[model samples]
Target chain A: MARYSILVTSSPFTSNGGANALAYCQQLVRDNHTIDQVFFYQDGVFHANAFMHPPSDEPNSVKQWVAFHEQTNTPLVVCITAAARRGVLSQQEAEELGYNAYNLLPPFSQTGLSDFFTKLHDSDNLVQF
Target chain B: MATITVRMTTPPYQGISAQDGLDFAMAATNYGHEVQILFEGEGVAQLAGQLTPPTGMKSHTKRLKALPFFDIEELYYCTQSAQARLTDGQSLAVAAEPLSADGVKELMNSSDHIVTF
Candidate 1:
């Protein structure tokens, strides 16, 4: 199976880009392709927000992603610069920065955008949705 | 040696996506990849030469001008969308090329990878 790396750059709350990326990722895995990782950049960091509480009946794209990672053991990395600017902090970052709350939870970690370039090289396909 | 295409689908002035797309394309060049920047859809507006942001706002023109210095000269805007701007008397950023629908198709078909913002 070819490896796939998906880059999601829009907030899950603001647009369908995050959901779209997830669906694409699912299709890739369903086709017997392997996912190297999901690199979240720009507003896409919102997908990592642990505190996200979607209203009832709304598709919880964030949890859907978490479940995907849980199923396939694929790694998810959020762009550090973009996540920080938007206040999508990991628990450690929130404690260090003295923020009242933190959102980045399990199944998602942080990395620089440059690190993604290397990951891209290792992947058979890189799709940004 | 990989041919990477970064396609921006939104205008730079509207949000950070366009700027971030440019940044990644530049990063690809830094990594020695053959990077091509393609502006599509509303992204075509990002290549307009008449962009003049109010004082204190980032000047996209300045950032675009720096792309050539990075040896990333393969810049193009969709010809299908060009009519939207040409009909309004707008022109692309200096030296930015036009990519016909077929050319865009060719790039996607040939590139090792495609990333859109």
Candidate 2:
């Protein structure tokens, strides 16, 4: 199976990218392909939020993603620039930076948007979902 | 190296852009050419699941899946875009590498032809 790198840069509820990103990952796993990583940038950082609460009746896409990451140990890296632009800060970081607590989680790590470059370079294939 | 990367710049269901993009990718793959799909801006929505297409429209996600049959296995999403704007995780169901600015630039560079829809 060929390995791939999928990038998700849209919000889950706002438009289309959110749902598509999750579906793509699931199919890849089903195909028995290796996913090198999933990088979150621009408005895509919210997927890393641990407290994302959708209605019980509604299918929880974010929760499903969390489970995917947890089960697969997939690395979900959030872009620091976009997160800061959207004012998504941790409790401690928010207090230190004079902001409100917007998100807190462990499956995600914050870094520069440029960090994902190496992943793309080394990837056997790249497809955007 | 006539590798082509199909870049999605529009959101799904907004218009025919996503469908059009998929059609083009499929055509290329059917011709036995290397094809890749990259989502930027709102294009990442193409991978979002649970979408009810407007009226008679078919889901772009379904079309996206068929790409592999044509050997168009390259699919990517902007991780930065997904995290910053994505409201829910269910919408994005693909395995992707979140791309940075540099990654995008490099993708553009590596591709022999970049088609944006």
Candidate 3:
């Protein structure tokens, strides 16, 4: 099975890219393919925002991503530069930046682009959305 | 190290995709991977010569010109896309080769990984 590294570069609500990436990941899991990582960059960092609250009936893309991570044990990495620029900060990052609050959700860690390249080097394929 | 191709389809300055794609390409090269950048669709605008960004906008042309310094020498643009968008007398700022559809297919097929922006 091919190893895949996924890149999400669009906002979760503004576009369906995040949801579509999740579906692709699910299909990969069903096919027994290995997922090396799901790297979020640019506006895609919004996928890890813990403060997002949609209507109860609406689909929560962040929650769905977290669930996918749980099911597949795949790493969800958000680019720290992009996340910080968009206010999607982890507790440590918020503290470092002197923000009183942080919104980066669990199961999603903030990292540099170097980490993404390292993972991409190890993967057989890279899929972007 | 892997041979990676980053295919850009977004126009420059309008969104962060163009900048992000260039940044990713540089980062990949820094990590000792082979990187090729392909500009297609609206992305071909990124290589247009004599681009002048509005006040407060970063100069994409300058950044693109510095790609060779980062050791990313393989640059390609879709010939059809450029012909459709660029009027007569317009030219590319960077020294990128024009690729037909088949050439683009070969580039993607030969790369170990393909990333689109």
Q: What is the lDDT of residue B79 in candidate 1?
A: 86
**Sliding window of 10 residues with minimal summed lDDT for model 2 chain A:** A113-122
Model 1 CA lDDT for position A88: 91
Q: Provide the TM-score for each candidate, comma-separated.
A: 0.88, 0.52, 0.95
Q: Residue B21 of model 2: what lDDT?
A: 70
Best by DockQ: 3
lDDT of 2 by residue, A1-129 (tens): 976666666776787777887778888889988888787765677776666778899767567777888888777777676676676665666788886665846667776534554455455665554
Report the Cα interface RMSD of each model, rounded to 1 decimal. Answer: 1.5, 10.8, 1.2
lDDT of 2 at B14: 82
Candidate 2's residue-wise lDDT over B11-95, tens digit each?
8888666775776577665554577889988887767777778989887767766777878777787777776657765556555
Q: Write the per-residue lDDT of candidate 3 for residues B1-117, one digit (tens) a residue.
A: 899899989888886889888898999999889999999999998888787887787899999988998999999999999988877667779889989999999999999888888
Error of 3 at A94 (Å): 0.9
lDDT of 3 at B108: 91
Among incorrect, acceptable, medium and high, the docking class of model 3 is medium
Q: What C-alpha lDDT, on a 0 to 100 scale, does residue B5 get in candidate 3?
A: 90
Error of 3 at B51 (Å): 1.5
- Model with the higher TM-score, candidate 1 or 3: 3
Question: Model 2's lDDT to the true fold?
Answer: 0.71
lDDT of 1 by residue, A1-129 (tens): 898878888777678888889888888889999888899988888888877888878887778988999888889999888998898998888888999888888889988867887777778888777
Candidate 1 vs 2: which has more DockQ: 1
